[model samples]
Target: MKKIALLVLVLFCGTSNAQKKKKSTTNPIVAVIITKTENLTAEVIKPNFYIFRNENSIKKDTLLLKAFSSSITPTDCVIKKFVTKSTPLYYVSWTEKMNSETKLKKETIVVTNVQIWNPATKMQVFSNTQTSTNIKEQVFLDKNKTASETQERNRNEGYNFTLLPTGDFTLKNKAVESKYNLNTVTMKYELPQKSADVSKSSKKKKK
Candidate 1:
């Protein structure tokens, strides 16, 4: 009787260990939500969103046991456009406030940041903050503008980006027509900067 009991105990232990290992082997799935700044939504982001899953920025960066959600999720972002339909390219931009010394008082309106967020990596890849060269004449008015007025009027001059699968995209100052060129730009590279350590999952976005 004692010998029989020992054999059963060994087998039970082995089965338990196997089950634990299988649970750990399960892959992890993350949620990704890309926000579009109003006007660009129809042309840039919404048009080809299905392609995003194939993008290296979205695919290669994350691990998946499984993730499930709406095909795409939408969020609001504040972006001001200087020209409408002048160029076929679409872009999203965000700005930071800075106090500029003026004769009458201080002023604010310089966009110092633009970036894309990867839910899988929980990392915000930043754009070239040095977009001074690309700001087109009409994109943002610079001539004959006051300090405060110049800061507010000059939207396109501050920053711009082109979304690419590699995630290492920079824009040419010249405008070009491309479906993937729709990019997310922010005045701060860190979106939801407060949540540095949090890794987002599809469940969170659904909520």
Candidate 2:
């Protein structure tokens, strides 16, 4: 009888400990790339975008916007314009608002804006504004700690923008594209590089 009682207690403790363990979660960072192609023009153009944000608002809220051109060639005309003329081919902004008491319990309102221009001519080509709602859930392992996992639902309106080699922009949502020219616009999701990798690349470039 004594042996059986000890075994049951051990089993209960093991189950309770297993229940206390929390699973880990990850939040991924993604990037948007826009490319343009035209049937008449053989040259494929990939324009760079600049991002601007309200620092004060970001500090108070969970909003953030990060944009940069992937161009690394020093001799590229786009790089030259960016360095000497301080011109950006595109401008983008992102904003978000919570619609419920708990971040995980409710949907969020998201607004995205993009403005395109001719860098050389400095003429505005077109501007677009999109408003949509998304649901983001974050799970934490402990109180006041960072989330272990994060999941998003109905994000970005299920739209994927593609820039055909022919210099035309195609959006998965045709209705939105009909009103605006989405030329040379797309987005991508990727994991961030480690600091060590970044430093090594910088060192190689310097050498």
**TM-score on alpha carbons, each prediction:** 0.24, 0.28
Tens digit of per-residue lDDT, candidate 2, span 129-162: 4567777777677787764677677755534444
Residue 4 miss distance in model 2 (angstroms)? 99
Off by over 4 Å in 1: 1-93, 104-108, 130-159, 164-170, 174-207
How close is each model in CA RMSD to the real structure?
Answer: 21.4, 23.8
How far residue 21's Cα lies from its native spot in candidate 2, in Å, is 53
lDDT by residue for model 1 over 1-207, one digit each (tens)? 999999999999999999999999996654334442332221123223211223433333221211223342323323322321122222234333444554534444343444343333444433444223222122234565533332223334533555454323444444532222223442222334333234355447779
Per-residue lDDT, model 2, residue 104, is 49
Residue 162 lDDT (model 2) = 45
Instruction: Point out where model 2 deviates above 4 Å.
Output: 1-105, 135-160, 174-207
Q: How close is candidate 2 to the true structure, as a TM-score?
A: 0.28
- Evaluated against the true structure, the overall lDDT of model 2 is 0.41
